[model samples]
Target: MAMRKLKHKQVPVWIRLRHLPVELWTVKGLSTVASGIGRPLYPDAITRACTRLDFAHVCVMLDVSSKLPKHIIIMMPKEEGGEITCKIDVEYEWLPPKCTSCMTLGHMAKVCAFTKPSNPAIPPVSVLFLKRYLQGHHPCSRLKGWTNRERDELPHGKTKREYRRLKGWTTSERDESISCRPKRRTTKERDESVLVKEG
Candidate 1:
């Protein structure tokens, strides 16, 4: 049997709250603190029983696009009518892969279909391949000198024939452009050329 792929943007996640004050162990207090991360669902069995003083486990309905903060600051009212600040640490048991481009769950931003270039002239390259190529790892590193803006105008992951056809460049023009680039000279050859120039 085939099952349909479900796109889950919002999910219930179990988060551990650390450094929680003794007074905030109640249901009301736990909900208030958990609300900082997401809509508070309910606390775990241990949390409800107050059997564990180390941390409180609460299930929250979290949105994939919500910012995951390491720590959250909470203000508590003191007996003297002033407020005291408390810092709570948050820990997620697990998180699903999220796509920042589409702001959805189950996929990462790099492989996001929405981020793929719409123009057929620019063949789509994997984010990892494009990153490495830009860093001079690819054999076609000659194109490394081109800025991102310029590279956006060029066809990537295409053969020379395809590139020529896409850019409407003739063989002579392509050869001329290739020849215009400065050739790499060895250290010894460069020194000899310098000595000859000085002579």
Candidate 2:
């Protein structure tokens, strides 16, 4: 028998595109252009229509049953009076969490307070030192890092905050296991309301 080659099946772009329409790195450009700034069109059906119709207005509409973006859709509208009207989309970059130290994100460690002018590398020993100084029972007392200067500088003063943490010792404080119990007495004689005649 003649040697036969095992053929690998090729998935069409249409099938693959149905799963992931764009690659990860491609989003930023898509976001800028999609927001209406001009750029190169994503090679899709809309481009061919614009080429044929030569219509000044063209848009790359989306079928959102898959709901990639729940609320917004990108539209390419014609400029009222401009030479270049072709539009593109750049994907948005999601803003990252703010650094309490440096107050910005997208980058950390490089620009953070722990490495900046006032701050230096936070050693584990610095935290143990703060725990010794603060005299706090807070879980954060065990946290590692230099204490925020404001926290370390608080004036020695009596605060309602201190008393709130301690249990009250008065008998009224005991209510002695009371919320679970019924206020009414339980005995049969007590269950019946008592009346006294004034002579």
Candidate 3:
């Protein structure tokens, strides 16, 4: 076993938070990001777990507004035969699961995926997003093409008037026909009625 004294620096943001509202999660080892670029000499598993990064290795400054812990610990490569464990300590905002059923995050009862009618807990919002992702159908607001109205005019969206137009229907002449006085009906019907009364 080799141990060397490394230089430690005070945290940057810690000095600023005089005490607003914070729950710190302290881990005891360096992140996999550190070792991936240069090996911390820990192991493989540690590298995989700690190096789970999103947004192109950009340090995502998590918002601490959620009612979750504000700290996290990252584990390093586990030593063979379970001897050495590299614990990475991280201090940041943790978004705790506001959901009581699954204890997950960014979800409500209406949108949890893990929830079933019988054994339901989490909201189904996650499921909805998943379905939309799989279907590859985005809302009209998100689309970039001509737009819903234009697309509707093209083929898919057909209303009564639109359907009629597709069927080659035009304005009917009968609909525009006008009523005339008929020249007082030639006065013949009136004369005939008078003769019948005389008979």
Candidate 4:
């Protein structure tokens, strides 16, 4: 037999119904409440046994395109004649990421292949490149701004003696052979300088 791949957009997710009325604890009531969200499958063992009163767990088949509501209003028949309204909160246990670009499941719309990036001017960074950059394994030359340590470690065509001599010299001199950028001062240093100027 030839194997065939099946793509299903509708998925069964376990949802919790909170603040349910006492009259709606039965199978029919649970089904009626869950129907508002999706196709109700069945309640959990605990829900059926009524062991836990916190919430009722039910498996609901939800479509990827369907709107996931946070709360649903239910109309309960009063003892006299008119029906009373009650609000029940719906909590999904787990839901797969859906892509709105292609109307498919598994991936989000932001990272979808069919969807174009909002800004084409800036290129997206790869996971491996970001990981290596974070780990300090990648070269800092490609980056726009460089830290003091990175600047110090950068290759300059100067001799060891000349490099050591230039290291101690803090003069603000910019030469073609040597790149001399002023060191960034901390907030405390800036505050001290401000006080000295004020005095």
Candidate 5:
């Protein structure tokens, strides 16, 4: 027996396309060129004929529906073909949010009843290490392979000094100001300076 494949139904999303050329406002003009950017919503997608829902007073609103999340459609006018360049805005402000917890649409994680109970929050040990590291409290020995001058030159805070003392690492009287460190000249600057001298 040949198994028939199940076709998944596409959800129609409402989107507003803005800044379309005034000429392309008609169903025929929009339908002809719209597919090049994104699939039109339906009910005369190809002909792009405005459905009862898409029509406005004195204007025919083209159906701009797609199964895709987002699109940046480019269109060519019938008269000009590929000569003129233009951009159209496709807004999906009415699209519902897909919930992560429940694997359903229209709600967020905060309101989803399917969300798992979270464990009690505990303070992380890495936070202390990171705070110390950012405060110029890293071990001097970690500066290995760097110049002895740079190693001796790096600064640590008073709190860092206390921590370093506790760790039995050498504490120095030298400046521990991380931001005040002199900027090293790069090769580009050196080359530019040499070129300026030659010029």
Candidate 6:
């Protein structure tokens, strides 16, 4: 065990936190960051090594540099993981962009083989609206408010007229269509109808 400890101590590993907030250059903030980094890296879980914070940067020491993580999580005192928390967003030092489609890293889902290719026929905005918007289809604003006079002047009058007609479907028409549809018979109604027929 003594020999192993000596061998491990021979190699030194270090990491730097670049562009650290100027406000967090104080002793307390630096110590906290250092402690947080040290806890997971050390087998002993010693959190006392974050003593160095120099010029918007923090230098941390670790036992093994090869196993360094891509990113480090630091909790700020101002907010405790709330929506309004003042977060310190840091890019990973080594990890690539994650592909949510196949749940992998190093590439995005756009070129993922497991995912089906997006339909070329559909507009991107339409696809986004379909995913995000819960309400029924809404015509684009330019297609809306197209007056009959404007439609006559435009070369695509037939298409405009059809679109306007479709959009002009009234609440009365919706109600009429709904009333015209057959209603499902409830269990009680079915039983009552059977009894009446027997009577």
Best-matching candidate per TM-score: 4
Tens digit per residue, CA lDDT, model 6, 1-23: 45521223112224445545555
Compare the candidates by lDDT and give the number of the best one: 1
Alpha carbon lDDT at 28, candidate 2: 49
Candidate 2 Cα misplacement greater than 4 A, ranges: 1-35, 46-120, 123-199
For all predicted structures, in order, the TM-scores are 0.55, 0.15, 0.16, 0.56, 0.33, 0.26
| Cα RMSD (angstroms) for every candidate in the order listed | 17.7, 23.6, 23.4, 15.4, 19.7, 21.3
Hey, what RMSD does candidate 3 come out at? Answer: 23.4
Off by over 4 Å in 5: 1-10, 32-39, 42-71, 75-82, 100-103, 113-115, 118-199
Candidate 5 worst ten-residue window by lDDT: 158-167
Clashing pairs in 4: none
Off by over 4 Å in 6: 1-5, 9-14, 39-55, 77-199
Give the least accurate 10-residue stretch of model 2, judged by summed lDDT. 10-19
Q: Whose lDDT is higher: candidate 4's or candidate 5's? A: 4
lDDT of 1 at 2: 95
Residue 21 shift from truth in candidate 3, angstroms: 29
Q: What lDDT is reached at residue 87 by model 2?
A: 28
Put down candidate 1 lDDT per residue, 1-199, tens digits, no spaces: 9996667779999999999999999999999999999999999899999999999999999988779888989999999899999999999999888898888888899888778767649587698767755554333344456322232232455322211111211224555333333456667655554211111
Residue 96, model 2: Cα distance from true site in angstroms: 12
Better of 3 and 6 by TM-score: 6
Model 3 global lDDT (CA atoms, 0 to 1): 0.31
For candidate 2, give the lDDT: 0.33
Clashing pairs in 6: none
Query: In angstroms, what RMSD does candidate 2 have relative to the true structure?
Result: 23.6
Any idea what lDDT model 4 has? 0.74
Candidate 6 residue 51 Cα shift, in angstroms, is 18
Error of 3 at 81 (Å): 15
